[model samples]
Target: MTITKKQITFSQAINDAIQTAMAIDKSVICYGLGVTDPNGIFGSTIGLEEKFGSQRVFDIPASENAVTGVAIGAALDGVRPVVVHQRSDFSLLTLDQMINNAAKWRYMFNGIHSVPITNRLIVGRGWGQGPTHSQNLQALFSHIPGLKVIMPSTTYDVKGLLLSSVFDDDPVIFLEHRWLYNQVGLVPEGDYRIPIGKAKIINKGEDITVVGMSYMTIEALNLIAVLSENKISCELIDLRSIKPIDSKCIIDSVKKTGNLLVLDTACKFGSVASEIITLVVEECFSYLKQSPRRITLPDFPVPTSPALTSNFYPQDLKIMEVISEMLSKKINHQKQERPPISMHDIPGDWFKGPF
Candidate 1:
């Protein structure tokens, strides 16, 4: 599938995608905070109310849990509902509705009920929003058993993933990075859908496999360019869908590259990164040449100051540094583990973590 190069901002691409879906499917309804009212905060859903009418695109009360529960109920009754949470941090309010109700309804109902609901969340860091507003909670949703978690970094993925999410029978948590909304990219002119539970290989390389999602995917792309300039070829995998992850792609990439680096914006501990790393090690341990390293935000709460936040959040430079160190260690290990290599010959730190 070839995508034409046409410039468009991320937010505009998302809006166009939703509008296109609504035009074709009357059951597709969008509702959330400031989405249908006087101020559509990001303008992603602006003018949608006019075209779709108030019934399809309307605003709800300032209750995240209630709004999500309403969407879940509608979805059960055959309505493809898209519930938007203005901020990712606010999704905490709907945990019960999401995890217990929406996620388990189908199993609890013996497959008679399906939750075809899409919960759109905006994740942002820095910009002086403080700890509360700047949290990246994709990992939290990804941990749930029945939810499909998607965090697209590019405008193309945003449109394709959202379109796919609308059609999926299971509940989907679509995370949009607030920082990438204005960033421009070329998207196909017509309706399209990128398959859910698929990973895209952004760059081909032989050295290390870097798995990233959401805005961190873009950061990984940038680091890949820099690493290439230094003669370090890195295979980049965009985990577009966090849940029902494309483990085959990751395993294959690690088998070829012999090293892995899982990068994420979520906290370092108990994050999606840990899950990815676990999968790679468990499935492709023999293929790995060195320990898998993860570049992620510190476990502490997000700081308010720009300088402090920058240090707390995982960035391109930090990723590059970690990758370089891993590569160096791999080279040294290969030299030591020659001919009759034993388990002890392999680096001890490589097996420290479970994954």
Candidate 2:
């Protein structure tokens, strides 16, 4: 396993992960909607079919449930299938297959059999994706037993986690935020793996514990500089894995900081954010200095208009405001920074959409 480093976008890292996995394993297969398209699902699947052949990397009809069922069957028969859904909302069509069968096959068989399937569900907010097209369902999937949910925010983690998911002997819900596809970072060359069920402390501070998932992690990171300047030290935790969440890391952080703030991409009600707050309250209630707080989208369908979408999606400024209130400090909006309201519908100016 030779290791070198180079800058790459989040989506390229994903493509590299799948390419590496398929290159090393004969049984690893990749298939899903728009997989073989020229655009290659935002270039994450480009050149895969040509490199590995259509037998292993092919397109499927838009029957998500049936396709997922077939993939689960293949996994049980010793094939590692990586199924990609263009939108996380599209995954709703396959819930019965995912929750009932794929997630329980190993347990139902007393651990003798396993479903080595990886479902890559794309999720995000942007460009009038609206309610139906842009839904963050990490919490919904994390509720199922025997299923591992992963949401990798950075380029490095995405590659490592995807590789791990593909090779794991159980079902893995690997979600990627569409906005993160263009995020560039230093990714190690060659194959490597980040263990499932682990959280990473991206920024360390003694004031507050901020746990974020997927794109929310990026938002949390952006606040570190402003928060620190205001004498508010923030300990930022990127929850790389949603289910089998890193309880020890979160508990330890809250014990030290005594304040908790969770930023989840999902809705406010019954979200992964709620689960994290509950865990902190249960494990470190006495250690907390203030009540745990979570910043999430309101419990309503996402609006399509740019004006509404701007307020719908929580960003760094919102996190800053929440942190200020939690710490009893006034927010200096003049010192805070954010993408212009004009670009609120997209992640950044660089975002040219295929949506």
Candidate 3:
């Protein structure tokens, strides 16, 4: 097992994934708004058009529905099209094409056709982008049966998952959190494909498990470090794919720790966290020592003000506070489960306060 290192931003990792996939498969094509040439927004697709040439990597007009329709048609005709929407909110404009067309094509055609297309969406709540641009709509596409929804939190996962998405037979909605573009992580030097439905446990611990996706995974890791300094250990699970969720990983962790906490940038209701909690309760209720808790953005549209936006979204501090409370409760419950022992059985100064 050899390790190779390269310093690349999150956005560059995505660009690498697209480039590698296209190099591997000639059928793979990239297109969408700002994905081409001079001054591409945020530069995620920078240099792609030049390297792949206009025929393979071209730009589309400001019509998401039309672009999506074209991608789906291409997929049906045996071409793998990777379409990008400027923002996650823009995906709403193509709901008809996605929900009715891309999602139902194989089923409607009785397996005679497959939509091997990837729709890349940039999502986040920042820079006063406000209500229109800050929405995290991965949950919406995850609801559709035939669509695969992937939200990678790290550069490695982004690279591997994006490669896998381009080759998958079903249509995929890849939601890239805009705010994570600059965050750095180590990625393998060569091409690799991470299994679509598997989850990765970034940290291991016995006390509790924190499950998150995209930027929320970064927040979970940050909270884990903070809690460790306080002598509390936590496991972090990154659910890279939302649609085909890794329930086995989630349930196994909950069983081992007997406690669960989900951190999601999306709203609390009808979100990925809600579905995960429901799955854990249904599958591992006997193993759970306490009820699962979730830290999520408030169930409302994001605000424009920076101060208000910070308050609206979930943060590391909020995650740390919730974990502390859960740990305290767990300690109390353990005390009740065990029998009391004599003073001689206890450690010295056990009853002393901060001594």
Put down candidate 3 lDDT per residue, 1-355, tens digits, no spaces.
Answer: 8868688877888888888888888899999988885755466788888888899898888899988999999888889999988788989999999999999999998999998999999885565778888789877889889999999999878988999999999999999987677677888776889999999999998889889998889877765555666677788999999989999999999999999999887888898899999999999999988899998888888787756655677666677678878878322111222234332211122222110
Candidate 3's displacement at residue 90, Å, is 0.4
TM-score of every model versus the real structure: 0.90, 0.97, 0.90
Q: Model 1, 1-355: lDDT tens per residue?
A: 7756578888888888889889989999999888975557476898999999999999888899988899999998999998898788899999999998999999998999999999999886555566787788877888888899999989988998999999899999999987778778988876899999999999999998999998888877766656766788899999999988999999999999999999888888889999999998899899999889998888888776655654666666668778879887322111212133233211122222110
* Preferred candidate (TM-score higher): 1 or 2: 2
lDDT value, candidate 3, whole model: 0.83
Candidate 2 residue lDDT tens string, 1-355: 5578999999999999999999999999999999999999999999999999989999999899999999999987899999999999999999999999999889998988899999999995788889888999989999999899999999999999999999999899999999999999999887899999999999999989999989999998887877777788899999999988999999999999999999999889999999999998899899999889999999999988887876888888889888988999985657636656447678877886747
List where candidate 2 sits over 4 angstroms from the true fold. Answer: 333-341
Error of 3 at 37 (Å): 4.1
Model 1 ranges with Cα > 4 A deviation: 1-5, 37-39, 329-355
Q: lDDT values of the candidates?
A: 0.83, 0.92, 0.83
Please estimate how well model 2 matches the true structure, expressed as its whole-model Cα lDDT.
0.92
By lDDT, who's the top model here? 2
